[model samples]
Target: MIGANSVLTLAVNIGIAAISYVMTIRMIPRFREMFIKANLYGKDLCKKDEKVVPESLGVLIGCVFLVAMFFFIPIPFTFGDAASAEVATTGGRSEVFPYKEFVELIAALLSICCMILLGFADDVLDLRWRHKLLLPTIATLPLLMVYYVNYNSTTVIMPKFARMFVGNTLDIGIFYYVYMGMLAVFCTNAINILAGINGLEVGQSIVIAGSILLYNTCEFLLQHQLDAHLFSMYLMLPFLAVSLALWKYNRYPSQVFVGDTYCYFAGMTFAVVGILGHFSKTLILFFIPQILNFLYSIPQLFHFVPCPRHRLPKYDSNTDLLTISTVTFRAEELNFIGKQMVNIFRFLKLISWKDHADGRITTNNFTLINFVLVIFGPVHENIVTYMLLGLQVICSIVAFFIRYPLANLFYDT
Candidate 1:
């Protein structure tokens, strides 16, 4: 049940979240000039005038979230202890620490800290693509280790249709653990690769976090694993607070860039909540757009098609509109297999492309930002961002539908 103490703790956390929001908003303006002086600035490629704005300000959210989490730790443990003190005294079971929960909390914090460090390093060093993709795997090890130590449920339910062939569940053993690690990597890179336009990254983050927060609240009220859902809520509230603050300036007609730092930290934060809350599958549903973006990008990612340095939409200075960018392929550069894959993409109309008179081919880059541009045919930046945000919202609704009503048809409750 949702007790008085739980309600009180939530109120206190809301206060803390509000303060985090204020701190982040104030810090952004202050950090702007300092960062520019340090040459940590980027040209707004989407803008007509191309203003040089302070970049990598997303590290601020990481810092503020960390600080809030550190100072706020005592509240949860103390309150839980206070709530159960009478049982401890009367039952004479003796005092016992909530050791498992404590370890989980500490592990989550340490893992997030590692991601923040890695993200900042990427921004400063401009590491290679290989390092960029694989370093997050290293950062996720702490989380996997803690999961293995604390609550290692390696079994998963079989779909109702497949149950007759096997059984109700399958013990996947170590492969389940493998899936968790890959989730972390995918989450980090998914957010990174889907971004380019102003406010798109942070805006999508807020939508996903908010959707998870909503789900947690529902699960808590339904009294199904209240503690786990509460654990999830604590992490998400502060994230939304900080992310909303960052999004304010990062949004269309942007004032600041969120940088790779914010994306990594934000992705890892979602991963932590989903893993610790015991809802990783449900968490993934909210990422439909990201998943689609990745699938569309497979050809370019594997080098079957030529991938540009930046796959973001192109800006038309004269029209002040952004159009979908393209990847170019020359016959000599592509192998047989690559050419086949490219032809498959074109035949399916999965992409829009043209055969140049100069014996070259050009096709739309496989990114969600550009995909949206292709659909709408070059609109205003604000309009494109809003449409993407709307898409995120719609995906959340679809996720809930699949999780609840639709899921009953596929699996046992």
Candidate 2:
């Protein structure tokens, strides 16, 4: 017979998969209707319309299914104060499951509501960005509550060389709240931005879930920490469920997109879990791609760089020379330069002077710099660990980028 734990996990997984299949079926027609009503069919706003569904309804149903799964799952067993007491008798210090879980769940629900309501409003009446920001900000209060209730007193800031050099002692009082609030806001926005492409945000969530699982497994091996492992297992369920469910429609030529609602909730859950596991550093490494994307786009968003212009350097077909006027550097410029360098390195021996002699652009090699970064960018405490991280990063980056061209080359009709 299967162990009780394994049985429960299997049951939960099957239940969620069943629910997701049902929800997807129920949602497709509604999605079609919404797309037709919005006049968004066969547009660049979305990739395809045959499978496209209404974002609001799909998100709402998905969230409900997720919440129900959480309640039904036996792992990360939710308990009352009495149950907490019982567990404490077994040497558990905390009588209750960490309050953070409940708080995060509620926060997720509220954020879902905000996104759905705003999306619906935008679809119907077209709400502006100001309202969109305001509504979500207001709805994020529950998240702030979680921050205050669970992490308010927690020490988030550590003393660094700057503090000692400046003769400033660390202030744990107000700083903690400020730090938590900032983290919450930043996570919410980062996830939102990362939601630009189908399956992109969900893929990032998978990376995080996998990392946490690894961390928990390591703790189990090193410290025999059953509780931590159990917690990680519990956390993995929702993420895994959502990822698989979303993937059903979000794979190549995606049918539906998990918009800000899903992305924000996923990000918040990741942040909370990372905080709980005390794996903030690991979390950062896992999410380095999204973080770098965010950092790179910030300047463009603020108009610090040229606006509404996406100019690529003009290449002379005959001379194979770049001839774009350069006044100031932009993010795209840096990216283009990097791409050129990588391409030049890749084809140094093959390309004849005649190729550039004609000033004609013959090849596009955008992934070369990305390849180098993935192969060498990972930093770790030990040489072995560093090598492992570098290899993992390279594999991941290669897999993600190669998917695009490979699909285009082989699958595109």
Candidate 3:
């Protein structure tokens, strides 16, 4: 049964979510103005003209989330039992200030804040892709340190097939930290890569956060579990609230841009929840679409195919439609190795390329957005966003089902 502290914790969690949402909604205009005044504007490449937009309003959401943390996180709460209540209340409120898990979560929050700053630096400096790749790894050090100090279980249960070959659990030892560090790097960059359209980054994040909220609720009610899920809800709810706020201005015909800051902030929230809440594997399942997109873009990313600075769809001012952005490269520019790779991609329908009479090869950029355009064939930007978000919802729902009911068929949860 739920106890008094649990009830209070729920009340605080729900209240803070509502408060954060309202705070973000009310403050968005102000933040946009601040961004404008600071000369932090970006050209919307999805438009034919260089449409300027106020950028990095995600700083508002990040700040609001951090400020909200200071209020509810330190309050003493427990999952179940009177002993937990004693641990919460018997000690003076002041004594509960330094609770271990709470400290860990706070550390995670600080790490995310640092990541947001790193993204802001990128927004200002326009860091190279190589530089951007390593910055998230640096930003995640504190989070990884806390995880190492608190819970260092590097053991992963072997799949049934793997178990057949080598029996039971496999301890990965030190590689586990490397795996987590890569997860942090991947989560941050994956969202950053699939971006360039209105609301795609924040929209997908909202869908993932909602899926996680549903999972946490299920664990709380169906499994009679708490703690970790409750902590997850604390992060997820605020993230959803703030992301929705950003989406308002970032949707079709956007008034402002969320910039990379939001991407890092959003991804790090997932990383923190997954790692600290002990559901990193399940959380990754929710990101299958992003992961698939990243995998699909690998050839272009490694320079076997040309990677553009902006992979946004071509914006036709006359039609006000976003179509595929085709890139052309001279045949000689692609060496024998690049030519063979392009042939493989074309056969897979992962790319559409043609050799012109002028000895230039033209092809659509390899990106989730461009791939969606290729499939649907030049729909409006809003329609494309809706379609992709629908796919994300479906993927997240299927992941949840796989982790829950189909556990025996898939492998143990």
Candidate 4:
């Protein structure tokens, strides 16, 4: 027979799952109503005066309620006889386990709350980018404090040359704090950016949640680390709940968007969990796609790329010294060259292109690149596993680029 703790866990999981399903069913009509109202408002406003239809109040309220409920359910860490006995048997630090679990759960809940608030503000009031950035950073303070208190310090990975040149210093205090802050911000933004399309962000979250669960399971099995497993399980429950709820409204022709709430929380969850579980390297490997997406989108955010003169006709010739007209190339020629560059990027499978007619083309040449990188990437004891990861990456890349481009072209056109 299962112990009381095990039975409680089973009950909690079932209750949460049932609540999620019921919430999803209840949310569908509300979502549909919101969608209809928004559409009607959008159409009427567009006819009279162009204005964006504001996101529904119902959705915002629902998100807030969910976030509140998550916090309200305080699942206190039980450092009971079993846990104490286990610690004694393993000769492990006694205080660390319960505290770590507590911190992680609190961090996850805090992160969720932050995301809900930020998401609500963005969805309803249409917050500026600067505010979004600043707000989330401010909101991440609790999680950061919890992390520092529990972990004591953040880990840093320096390049071999840098390490050799600088001599290993154990005292990285303020730097660690700043690094952690930056990580939280970056992850929050990465998730927000990737939430552009239906299922994309949610799918990524599912992948992350699954990877963390697997990693935690492995840690427990191999090292007899119950803390990691327990923390991961707690984190997974809410994520799985939210994913199911969001998926119902998010699956293609999305009735309701998870918006920044889900995105920010997803990123925060990954960051906090990784830090607590000491799975930084594995998390990095698992979230490579998100990393790639961030890398690709960073330049666009800065508007660093030079625009041709013809693209900006209002610029004074004298003031705008960087105008394409001042150069030898014509605007038309530059445009053509730009198009070619895009096509070339697509050909290389480094980027994607959407033509005016809605045709999409993506390059699939990166499969070989990924394979080579994997083969030479890490000297893992489990060479076969690394080999398999390489193969999966290559296969996924090829399938996505080759088929998606065609499908996108067909549907879009």
Candidate 5:
């Protein structure tokens, strides 16, 4: 039995999503044209018949979402008609405006806007990996500070078994803040690294957002207190709508590249929801694929193996198939210890290598894209994109179930 206020909230959310969808769909073409005229185009590497496409069109998504949020978020109008202010009675107590919650929402929205700007800067400047990685840490500071100020509970409930050994809850204190900051950085960069092909960035984002929305809906229904999950849904639903609309031009045969703008914006939106809704742990569960991909690339990222600027799949113009891109390591580039590590990974088949006569060795770039190419052999670009997105969907579903029903077995849910 859902309440009237809940029903009204649902209706309002749907209306907002509808508006965002229509506006994004209509605005994409104009943004694409603007990007093209501005000479902000990048080569499409996934397709054999690739052409330069307008990039950084995520500006449209960011603008539309922010505008829609500001206009439609139902902030109370407390002008001269102060007595006409809406009120609701819960347990014989009258409730007015949720000032604190609304303020938190505003802070979160502002942080996301900052991330959008940071991402756009990366798009235009072609920032170094270190700069790109560190910038998001700065952009997310506002939201994290708000989280610290508003709700500073650093105590987490232990698992049922752990509770028996220790206590019901443990206070992590300031380490929690560091964890939250790392989570923000990881979320932003994880999606950034997983991108290359058409639609991959925005496509995985749609799947992740949809998964969160579904899980949040479940929590809202099952939990007696609805506010926390409702806050998450408010952000997630509109994000899904806008991303779906963006998917039109970002899909196979992509007309516009979303650039890093969409990735940072989308990732920050998820972080904002998790922080504000007090469910950051559950949010990480939904990012299983991104997490795995990040871990898989860490060695190359840290120079344990050679890394190229871009690890996009090799496109066979004649066969119209995508294959793994290889990275070559110079003999002088590795120490004895690093070569030993490389041999271990190669023997484990996590990587493959060919020693050349010119004192060089070539191995496949270690990324999820290359891994897919390895297992599936040469595949069409669209097929690879869809496969990756499908993998995301499956992983998110497993994560949702693990955090819900299966959670009861491990934790006192």
Candidate 6:
């Protein structure tokens, strides 16, 4: 059975999350006006009417999240543990300060704050892809430093197949930190790259956040490192709550755009919670869709194929369905090696392409959304969004299955 302090912590966290949700929902319409007056708006491309919508409203969400976190900071310490409670009750004449949790929490918040600024600046300044990609590395410095100083563990469990070859555990030392930094970069850019539809970004974030919550709740109930799970819960609950609020208006007929800020904020939230809560490995499992999307996009991401500024699905007005958007180049534009790679991928049925009489070749951009379109053909934008979100859920379920029943095949759980 859970104790009083644990129950109290739940109530307080839930309370703050709910309030933040309500605040975001209520403030969006008001913020929309300010955004429009400040010229922070963009025209919707997919729609025939080219509707105007407020942009960078995600900055508002990030600000509210930070404020809510400030209030949440004190509650965790007051109910953290016997030591924290004693220190709170006594004047600290002889009690030990709860330095570890305090520092970790502050560092996590600082890292998130930095990412928020990066995202906001990118939205305002239209930072180049190279610069935007590398900025996340700077934002993650605090998180890495905290991990190095507070709870550095460089060892990784060897898989069953490898255990016989190289024992049960292998220590890679500093490479682990490098891996975490890469994870932060991936987390920040994944949703941003995968976005185009109205609610797709926030919707996927909600699913991933909910998946993390489910796993953390299970771990909490099992009493497998309660403090860590609680920390995850505190970060995730508010994230899910605030995201749902945005989703209400950002769905099919979108009223506002989430922009780069929300994507970065959401990804950094997952990164921060996963790192601090000691479940970074498990956390990665929940991002299967994003991972697959990134892998499939390697060809286009590099100079192999000419990448466009916008890879979103084409909105066909004739049937009112979304179709795969393609990058077309003259047949001569592709060198022998690039053409060979394209032919190989086409033969493998990984992509679809068309040739025109004008001596040009066109192929779908490498993205999960386009991949689905290649399989299903044209469909409504909302239906496409649902299909991808459903895929995310399935991937998460597979992750849990692998983490639990199939554990013996992978590692010592």
Ranking by lDDT: 6, 1, 5, 3, 4, 2
lDDT of 1: 0.87
Task: Estimate, for each residue in 4-104, the C-alpha lDDT of model 4 and write its tens digit.
Answer: 66446545654665676566657665555555565522221111232233233324434633553464355333422223322322456444244455456
RMSD vs true structure, all candidates: 2.4, 12.3, 2.9, 13.7, 3.8, 2.1
lDDT of 2: 0.48
Higher-TM-score candidate of 1 and 3: 1
Question: How many steric clashes between backbone atoms does each model show?
Answer: 0, 17, 0, 1, 0, 0
Write the number of the candidate with greater lDDT, choosing between 1 and 3.
1
Deviation in Å, model 5, residue 205 alpha carbon: 0.5
**Each prediction's whole-model lDDT (CA):** 0.87, 0.48, 0.81, 0.51, 0.83, 0.87
Q: Please list the residue runs of candidate 6 whose C-alpha ends up more than 4 Å from where it truly belongs after superposition.
A: 85-92, 335-337
Write out the backbone clash pairs for model 6: none
TM-score of 2: 0.57
Query: In candidate 3, how many Å is residue 48 off?
Result: 6.3
lDDT string for model 2 (81-101, tens) is 212423333365545454455
Q: State how far residue 300 of model 4 sits from its true place (Å).
A: 1.4
> Which pairs clash in the backbone of model 5?
none
As a whole number from 0 to 100, the lDDT of residue 400 in candidate 4 is 38
Minimum summed lDDT over a 10-residue window in model 6 is located at 80-89
* lDDT by residue for model 6 (141-200), tens: 988998888879989888989988889899999999998898898998998988988899
In model 1, the clashing pairs are: none
Model number with the top lDDT: 6
Candidate 1 vs candidate 5: the lDDT winner is 1
What does the lDDT read for residue 205 in candidate 5? 92
